[model samples]
Target: MTLFETFAAHVDHALDALVAAGTLPAGLDRSNVTVEPPRDAAHGDLSTNAAMVLAKAAGTNPRALAEALSAELAKIDNVTAVEIAGPGFLNLRLHATAWLDELRAIGQSGDDYGRSASGAGKVVNIEYVSANPTGPMHMGHCRGAVVGDALASLLEFSGYKVIREYYINDAGGQVDTLARSAHLRYREALGESIEIPEGLYPGDYLIPVGQRLAEHYGDRYVAAPESEWLVLFRKAAVADMMEMIKADLALLGIHHDLFSSEAELHEAGKAEAAEAELRARGLIYDGELEKPKGKEIEDWEPVTLPLFRSTQFGDDQDRPIKKSNGSWTYFGADLAYHYQKSQNVDAMVDIWGADHAGTVKRIKAAVNALTGGKVQFDIKLVQMVRLLRGGEPIKMSKRSGSFVTLADMIEEVGKDVVRFTMLTRKSDAQMDFDFAKVVEASKDNPVFYVQYAHARIQSTLRKAEGEGLGLDATQLSLLGDAEIALIREAANFPRIVESAGKASEPHRIAFYLSDLAAAFHAYWNLGNDQPDKRFILAHNPALTGARLFLAANIGQVIRNGLRLMGVEAANSM
Candidate 1:
């Protein structure tokens, strides 16, 4: 039901007819041929590169091929005219009913109109928002979460079976520190005015965790050694933090299908097994690293450590899997974790924040080597978010207890606004999240703009029903320029869905929605200025039913797109 997809197929059919008539060579590789909107809309409704693409292969001049193709295409039913533009471009202008039929397709398929089978139902694993479980997610995590979730939805709609996952770093030094910090909270709960010393978490969020630990253990760990209570306290602290994280994600209506914990991976011997497998493949060996560039930690040195031969697989240099202190490095655990994770899926995707940009190459190299280059691992880096309100920046952080949580933001501006706003920009580009502007129901706010389009459609349909006109798909196929423009945008939805999946960019959906909404709004305003263009006709039932059908198709497209982005298409403004 995708307009571009159908147009391409139709063009191919026309070309096939030409080949059968001996106008074109048989067995031509038509894969490179494409049908797209002309750069200048006035030039034609659609333009194709078939003639240009085939010119060299068919041993003919581009203009000659275009002329021949144009002649063949001119006889098609929908094509009103076919012309050879400069450089052999074939511009095809279709009859108005061709666009009207496109409206019928949108009305028929509704939101499913844009669904594509580009992924071939392949399995895709998307790992995003691995925010350490150290604190509430910040501005940086928002983009990745939205991008990853929307990308997952896009892939699913495009025929991929997607698994959305989150990685938990519970087995790292940070959690050990959390255990110690919680022990402090546990002590403070026992009536001791404890001072949070250096290298300890100072955020007020730990206060409740401290109280919970105290209530559960009742000063039992107050006099215990760090060793005696570290494990228990770490478990409690990590659990509490993860609970907060879940609630935070819930604010955005996000829930991962799987949460793979680093601790669990180690506990289940996954890391050990992965490392052993790599070693067996001769991909692991002992080596002294070329002393790290920039500032080096005093504890790190060019000592003999277990290293992964990442250089063999296109990494910058071989990386140390084990630290000089004989403990496995974070990268080491990640490699094994990735290896274990890969065993379960056809492919792997890691969505990390901007700070993790440098880590992509090595991890991808490791996964490539460990999986015998059978699986492709991609890392999508979501850039940081700059929070602004009315032109000034919002300097806030949940980590330092200075800013609003995702929960607070949701409470302030409902989930739909939050979801749409987060996805309004590319994940790799820094986005300005303006608090004041986001809530405003206006053209500037994309969420409101799209919602307004849907709301207007609902009102139009109600008015049509009052006129006693049946506004179903069959009755809605009749469309004029405004209606055809809206339907043409809708017909291209599936194409956008597939493109977004292929590019791993969900922001495209947000932009596409913006475009669709604009088209619908233009149609709406035309009714206000020109009553003849209005969807409802009080005196003419047939025309009223036809316009009503246009409104319904647009409403369906908006609703379907909003659902994919986890936003709502409200019937009322």
Candidate 2:
């Protein structure tokens, strides 16, 4: 247990004692009570709002209850002082030995210092980078890919059985366009003049796919009509495009456990079955949708369509499942996909681009109705990324159909920089990815700052070991308040990981790592002014060993946190 958990347990014990003594009411709801660090470090090490929360239920003043609880909590181990702050807030101060014990625990736990079983082996399916199998991945899909992959890693670190998935959109009309484009390239490869008319992909990336087709068929399909070769070419083009997409994802160190194809879902009759199930549940109906507000629909006619009662699950209106031409709408296949996903996992997460914002409510409604509210589903919409170089907007590349491909960015900056920079902001917030700032070796670059801290610790450990410093006889009692403050900051890693995992936000790991690095950097700067503050002191071997122990544990934590973020902790600059 962490220091916070230990203190929380003590608080619970105090509450139990009060109830047993008839000093407080039994069966009080204490879920809202929290023991955490105070806003200002000068206030105390940890603060709790137990008294303020329970006072009204017990029919007593907050301060009166605070005093009683404080009296009971003072007897807990390692609690050196307990003071009642404003409005019955209880601030706690622990003995310095408590921090020493925590440092020892960090050393003993090693890489497992922050691992938690909060998820309890619950299977979580995270689908991301579901780009259409038509072209290369662009910068639009970059953030969602990194966010989803890192979130899966974070959940796995927190004891979740994570299934990283990618939904291949090969069943859409876009693949037909890709096939036609590839046919144009194949005709050109076979010594025929071809023009890529408007609305067809004109990127050079598909030239290889076209060459492969020409080499295999030797102009056999070149003279055939669209109906004779469209399906065969579409299948081959989608296969080659998926291979390119997989290679692009590999550039960013992402590999999904499952690649679910929409075409396969349709082929298996899952969509029809799902619709039948929903209709049996009275959720599917043939009805006319209300006119959309604030927009003009040309030739707006009331056509009866199969609809899902999405409004019953808090959506704005019922959703359409099929079109007037007897074709399944995109939402129809999506419902089947989510239903199929719900069968294998307790929870599901979809990482989508911000353009899909309007579809979130309906998709969530579909999942809820399909699983009878037994499956948990969430969608994270990643906003756009503005690529810049030295404050100037980077234009799209003509090499990939006027959109900057993720490969372009990865080629400019390495994969680690790309992945780390994308995660520095939350999913919903738009960010400017300045190439100059990302690669800058300054504190302005969070990735560099954090990695530099780890590198510095590595160099220090090498020096300490060269001086014959051993951890066997280190005296932790020699640590003072400054060292204790650093230790306390390091001890917050487990709490940060658990909280980030629960919230499904991997960006929290980035932010927490930056803070922890700042603390370590600040402490390292103190050694410059006073030689006694250094990690290595020739005159005091025991003190040096103890500080080195702290440094090693700090490095361990940096490694662990970076592992969760899918980043490597650098050993050298």
Candidate 3:
């Protein structure tokens, strides 16, 4: 158990003892109590709210309850001091031996030090970067891709059985347009001049698709009518586009375990089955939806269409499932997809762009009704990333064939920089990703700062090895207050990992890394002015070995934290 866990168990034991001694009522709920690091390190090592939370239920004032709890907690080994602070908060000061033991645990566990079973093997499905399979992924898709992938890694580290999924939106009109564009390219490949008219894909990306078509079938599809070749071209176009998409994702080190196709959903009648199920449950009906928001209502026809009673579950209005022409709407396929996903996982999360903000409520309502509230679902909306270079907005990319593609960004700044920079901000907040600042090797750049700390420690270990020094734990108790402060920061890794995974926020890991790195850098700077503070003291072998042990564990934690963020821990600057 971690130090926090050990202390929390002690608190619970003290509470149970209080009940046995008739000092408190039996069966008092203690779930509200929390043991955590004190905000101000000067206050204590750890603080608990047991007294504050249980005072009323115990029929005693908070101060009196705290005094009583402190008396019992003071007897626990390693708990050197327990003081009652504001409003009966119990601040604890553990001995340096306690932190030494934690350092020893870190050395023993190495990479597995911060891994947790908090998720308890619950099945989780995360769908991200579900970009349309018509073209390469743009910068608009980068933030969600990085965030989703990092969150998946975080959950897996916390013991979740994660299924990374990608939903291919191939059953829409976009793929048909893609086919027409490919056919135009095919005609061009057959030596006929073609103007990619307005409303068609004008990017040269389709040139290869057309060339391949010409190579395979020669002039058969070149002169064929749209009806004779639309399906074949659409199939080939989607397949080829998906290959390109996969390559782009691979550039960022993202690989999904499942690629669910919307066309397959329609082909397998899953959408129809989902609609029939909802209709049987009286959640589906034939109705007319309000006119499109922000559009003129004069041209809107008041015709009846198939609708789902999404408003019953907190949406603003009922949503259309099928058009008046009997074609399934996009939401219809989405319902089936989510239903199929819910059948496989205990929880599901969809990472979407902020442009889909208006659809969140209805989709949530649909999932609620379909699963009868049995499945846990969440939607993380990632705001747009404003790419910048040298303080100016970057506007275009030749590779994207439109805006900047993810591959373009990856190629320019590298995968580590792109991933780390995107995760430096929260998902809901818009960020200006300055190219000059992210790659700058300065303290202002968090990625570089954290990586430098890891690299510096590695360099220290290498130097110690050259000097023929061995790490010694017997002299760990010789560590001073400054060393303990660094250990305290390192000890918070497991707690931070657990909290980050629980909240489904990978940005927390990035932020924590910056803070931990700052602490390590501050400690390193102290050695410059004071010879006694250095990790390698030639005159004091035992002290040097103890400090090296501490540094090694801190580097291990840096490596572990970096792994969680999908960033590499550099061994050299």
Per-residue lDDT of candidate 3, residues 370-425 (tens digit): 88888899999899898888999988653336677778888888998888888898
For lDDT, candidate 1 versus 3, the one ahead is 3
Worst 10 residues of 2 by lDDT: 465-474
Candidate 2's clash total is: 0
Each model's TM-score, in the order given?
0.93, 0.96, 0.96
Clashing pairs in 3: none
Please identify model 3 stretches exceeding 4 Å from their true place. Answer: 57-60, 291-296, 397-400
Q: Estimate, for each residue in 1-573, the C-alpha lDDT of model 2 and write its tens digit.
A: 877788889999999999998989999899989998888888888999999999998999999999999999999988889999999999998999888888988888888989988889999999999988888888878899999999999999889999999999888888999999999999999988888898888998889989999999888988899999999899999999999999999988999999999999999988998999899999999999887778898988899999999888778888889888987899998999999989979999999999999999988988888999999999998998998889999777543488778888889888888888888999889999998999999998998999999999999888878888756325899988889999999999998888888888999989988999999999999999988898888898889888888888999999999988888889998
For residues 407-462, could you state the per-residue lDDT of candidate 1 as single tens digits?
77788888888889888987778788888999887898898999988898898777
CA lDDT, every model vs. true structure:
0.82, 0.90, 0.90
Task: Point out where model 2 deviates above 4 Å.
Answer: 291-299, 397-400
